[model samples]
Each structure stands twice: as structure tokens, then as C-alpha cells.
Target chain A: MASTIRVRATSNGDITEVQALIQHPMDSGFVKDSKGELIPAHFIQELKFEYNGKDVFVADWGPAVSKDPYVKFSFKGAKKGDDLKISWVDNKGASDTTTAKIS
Target chain B: MTTITGPLATRRLILQGAASVALIGLGNLPFAAQPARAAANDKYPEEAFKQKSEADAIKALYGKTAEPSDKVKLDAPEIAENGGVVPIAVTTTLDKVTSISFFVAENPNALAASYKIPDGTVPSVSNRLKMAKTTNVVAIVEADGKLYSATKEVKVTVGGCGG
Candidate 1:
């Protein structure tokens, strides 16, 4: 299956900016299906970014996050051509990981 | 050495069964929560996220209250056409920032997200969140062990019932 996470990181001088979009239902359990059954809450609990063997950023998300979440942030010390690793784990213990190069 | 080993064996035997049971019973106690908090780098903050109000969520997450600060900048839309995906962003000038968090006052659960800002990372975050209705959105920045906050009111046209 294709990776659920898509990330783009770019370096400008001393900082690298990162933007990521992940595919997930992010069900908050408040909505009902067509059958009127409540959709169980399913959302990414955590997402992480690592660079140079160190954690650059970590996001802990709750059900209030929008479906198909999108996030943007930046960090220093990573240069162009460096690898920035991104990963996420959902409430059901499902996880995905991918790496992107800082362009 | 032999005398010490004798007492060591005696104590281990005395503690073996009792200790296991005691630890099991102490789940959710301070003793267990301490270690869980110590290892919170990977632990999902379950209690913090489950809080129903904004103040309760902040207290559960940080165990402290935040003061309004000029150093923190919270950006949110004046009117959200779709409550499911309201763009929110926060940036701080405070030094030694350890984390940032968002809370929606009227959401069923107040905490929307929390971000750990490791050293060398910029203290700015942009993300989308679901809002149940028009409410105050607060951004808290934890820096040097102190919490500072900024708030903005966002009007929502359509509630995020499932969004």
C-alpha cells in the first residue's frame, strides 16, 4: 500500500521548514454513520519528526484534530540534502513512517 | 558477605509476592504515575486530552495555570466557514520553550493538540483543528518551566459535529 504520510522539507539558509499531510479518517466518535451507528474514535495520537539522530518535533493530537490532518513547522541545524524522518501512530496502534530530504 | 546474602534472600522472599500484588494495586497511584510522567516523551496524555473544559485540560496537561503574555502570538480566523478545519498557528519568542498546546473552550474535549519543541526547533506551529462552535481558542507556551498563553475568539458558522 502507498504510504499514508506525505512530507515536504526545505532548507533556507539556517532553517528548514517542514509541512506534512497524512491520510486518516480522524473520526471523533461524535458522528454517526448512515446506519446511525456511532463511528468509534480513531485518530492519530502522535506524530514525530527527527533529524540528525535527534528529535526535532513531536505532536500529540486528540480527536479534535481535523480529518486528514495537516501541520507545518520549522527547525534549525538541518541542511539541504539532509534527511528528515516523519512518523505517526494512531489510537488503534496503527503506524506509518516515511523520510523526506530537505531540498 | 554470607550474613548479608542471608538477609538479602530473606527480604527477597518476603517481598516477592507482596511486591507484585502491591504494584498491581498501585496502578494510577502517585508511585506509578511518576514513572509514567517521567517517560511521557512517548506516552499519550490521555487524561489531558479527555478533559471537557479548557481550564481543566490545561491543569491536567501542565499542572499549572498560564498567564496572558505578550511573548506568545496566537493566530486564528475571525470567522470559520467550516468548523472542521480551522487553521490555527502559534509562535513564541520566549527562550527555552519546551512545549506548545492548543485548547478550544467549547469543544467536547478541550485539548486539540500539544507539540513538544525540542532544542534547535523553532517555536512556531501551524495546524488545523475541529471546533464544535464559536469559542475562544487558547495557545499555551511552556518556556523555562513557566506557562504563558494567548487567546483569540473564532466564530464558527457550521459546527464540527464529526469534523
Candidate 2:
């Protein structure tokens, strides 16, 4: 299946700045559908970024986060061409994984 | 002009004393018991996120209240035209920052998002959040086992929570 995650990790020898954009409905459950029925909450609960088997950053998000969330963070100790792993799990247990090379 | 240094240093000391006194006036004692918590990195803070009140959410997440601090820099729009995607950012000069969290005062649930910053990660994060209406957006930084916060009011034109 196609990944719903797109990430860019750029390294400046000392720090690796990561920016990710994820596609999700992020339904807060309070919103009503076209039929006037409430849409159940189905937002990403946790998203993690790993580098060299270590967790660099982890985000625990609630439904208040906007749809198609975009987050930016930076970390040290990763060099160019290194693989950075990213993954997330939504409230409904749906998830996606993607890897990006630091450049 | 070099003789002005003597008086400047004395003035700085007086200002520092006044700042502490102001803190006391607000009923916050400096360096109170810090509720050190284990790193529940893999576990989602379900209870905290479900809290409707900001105080309850912070209590549920960190087991403590935060004191307002100038060191925690919160960058947010004064007026968010679209409450659905209000850009929020937080940065701190504090050392040993472990986590940072956002709270929307008027959202259905106050706790919006929390980010864990490992040792190598920078103590800064930027993300978009949903706001139900005009409200105060708070950014809390947990540094060196103590919690400090910064807040700003953001006017929302359109509510994000569906009616």
C-alpha cells in the first residue's frame, strides 16, 4: 500500500532537521458529516521518529491537531545519507511507515 | 562611564529580587516538588488528552501545575483566520527539556499535542492545531523535571470543531 507519510530530513553535520507531512482525516469526532451525523474521532495518536535505533522525537497528538498534520523538529547526531525512520498510529489503530534519507 | 557598572550591578540585583517577589505574589513558590515521571514514550496519554480543562489535563499528564515563565517562548498568531490550521510553535532556552505540550483553552479537549524531546533533539517544535473558538493557546515546557509555561490569546474567526 502507498504510504500516507512524506518526510524530509536534512543534516547540517551537527543537526538534522526533519519535516513531515502526514495525510489523515484527523476527525475530532465533534464534526458532523454531510448527513448531519457526528464523525467518530480517528486522529493519529502517536508519531515517532527514529535514528540509529534511538528515538529522536515522538509526538502524542489529540484530535485537536489539524488534518494533514505537518510537524518540524531537529536533532543532532545524524549525518547525510543516514536513514531516518518515521511511523504513526491513529486512534483506530491504522498506521503507516516511511523512511527518508538525511541529505 | 565605566563607573556606571557599580550602580548597574546593584540595580540588576534589586530587579531580580523584585521578580521573585512578584512570583510569590502569584502564589507560586520557586522550585517546588517536581513530579518526576517515567518516560511513557510508547504509550499515548489517553487520559490527559480526554481532559476538558487545561488544569486537569496538565495534572493528568504531569501530575503537577506549571508556573508562567518568560524563558519559554511561544510563537502563535494573534488572530487565526482558520481555526482548523493555526500554526503554533514553542522553543525554550531551558536545559534538559524532556517534553513540550500544547493546550487550547477553549477546545473540546484542552490537550492538543505533546512532543517528547530526547537528549539529542532540539527543544523546539512547530505544528498546526485546531481551535474551537477564540481562546488562549498555552505551551508548556518540561525542563529539568520542572514545568514552565507560556500562553497567548489567539482570536479565531471560524470555529474548528464542527457544529
Candidate 3:
């Protein structure tokens, strides 16, 4: 599967800032189509960020969250060229993982 | 220039006294309790997320009430043109911020999302939220064993939650 996460990481002093944007519909199951039919809930339930294999940050999201979520956070002890990974699992049991390098 | 030293001096002293009281209150907090609580490996409150009411969701998530604070900043549009995608951001200057959570007061499930901020990370997060209707969107910050929050009413032109 193609990567669904786009990330940018940069180092300033000792703190490394990581920003990511995920592609997802994040349906809330409450909206109706033109046919007046309710849409089923489909949204990312869990999103995890890791640094060098260690969990750095995590988010638990529900259907109320907007589609294509964007997250940005910074952590200490990370340097340029380090590895950062983002992974997410949706309500439908689908999941994806993508890696980026700290610039 | 007219000098009003008498009244100004008294006001300054009063403000100083209030600032000290606030400082003392913070100093008396149980700072050690925060790390111990965060270390327990707290899991996501599934029941809270399942709640349809804001009060119940907050109760299940924090097990306590949150006080509104100016220190917590919730940045969102006053009117969301599209309910399907509303951008919301929260940032807090509070020390030792452990987590930040978002809630849509009028959604079918009020709790939208919760983020666990690790130590040494900036206490700021932004996400797109779906608004079922026009309602208050709240941002709660857990810092130093206390929960502080800020709220903003987002007006939605179109309902996002499926009818």
C-alpha cells in the first residue's frame, strides 16, 4: 500500500520537531448522502509516533475528529538524521506505517 | 501630569498580594503525584469515548471536573463553513502538561480525541474535528495533576454527523 502519512522533522538545538498529515476520510456515521442514507462510521482510532523504535507520542481519536488529521509535536534528545515513524489504525481494522528522517 | 500615587500604590499592593496567593497555591500542589499517575500506564477511556453526553464523557475520562483557564488556548474558527472538516488547535503554557483532549459538546459522542504528551515535548496539538451541529468545542489540558480547559463555540453551516 502507498504511504498515507506525510511527515517533516527538523532539529532546533536539542529538540526535534515532527509534523505529520494523514490522509483519511474520518467519517462520523451521522452524515447522510444525497440519497438520504446514513454513512457508516470510519475513522482512525489510534495514531502512534515513535522515535528510534521508542514510543514518543500517541493519540486516540474518535469519529468526531476531522478528516485528514494533522499533528505536530516536539521532543528532546533527537538529532538530525534520526528515524521517526508514524502508524495509525482505523475503526475498520485497516492500518498503515510510514517512516521519515529528521532533517 | 497628574499624580495619583495614593490610589495607585494601594492598587499595586493589592495586585501584589493576589499574585503571591496564587503562587502559594501552586507551590502547595502535590507535584510528585503527577509523575506517579502518568507512570501507571493509563489506557484510553473507551467508555468515555462511547458516551453521548459531554458531562458523562468528561467524568469517565478525568473522573473529576475541569476549571476554565486562560492559560489554555483553543484556536478554532468562529464559523466552520464545512462541518465535515473543522480545524481546531490547542496549546497550553502550563508546566508539566501530560495530556490534551478535545470534546465536541453536541456531537453524538462528545469526546473527539485525546493526546498523551510525553515529558519534554511541547504542549500543543492540532486536529480537524467533525461538528454535528453548532456547539461549544472544548480543549482540556491535564497538567501537574490538575485539569484546565478552554472552550469556543463553533458554528457549523452544514451538519457533519450523518443524519
Q: What share of the true interface contacts does candidate 1 keep?
A: 0.91
Q: Could you give candidate 2's per-residue lDDT for residues B1-163 as a string of tens digits?
A: 7699999999999999999899786673222222223234457887788778888788778988899999999999999999999999999999999999999998989999999999989999999999999999999999998899999999999988889
After superposition on all C-alphas, the RMSD of every candidate to the true structure, in Å, is 11.2, 17.2, 17.7
In candidate 2 the C-alpha lDDT for residue A56 amounts to: 95
Q: Record all residue pairs in model 1 with backbone atoms less than 3 Å apart, i.e. clashing.
A: none
Residue pairs clashing, model 3? A30-B161, A30-B162, A30-B163, A31-B161, A31-B162, A66-B128, A66-B129
TM of each candidate vs. truth: 0.85, 0.85, 0.81
Residues A1-103 of candidate 3: C-alpha lDDT, one tens digit per residue? 6799999989986988888899998877877779988878889988999887777888989888877888777888888888888899998999999889999
What is candidate 3's CA lDDT for residue A78? 86
- In model 1, which runs have C-alpha deviations exceeding 4 angstroms? B1-40
- TM-score of the first chain of model 3: 0.95
State the lDDT of candidate 1 residue by residue for A1-103, as single tens digits: 9999999999997999999999999999899999889999999999999998789999999999999999999999988998999999999999999999999
List the global CA lDDT of all models: 0.90, 0.91, 0.84
Q: What is the TM-score of candidate 1?
A: 0.85
Task: Report the Cα lDDT for residue A3, model 3.
Answer: 91
Query: lDDT by residue for model 1 over B41-78, one digit each (tens)?
Result: 56788878877888878877887789999999999999
Arrange candidates by DockQ, highest first: which order?
A: 2, 1, 3
DockQ for all candidate structures vs. native: 0.58, 0.65, 0.47
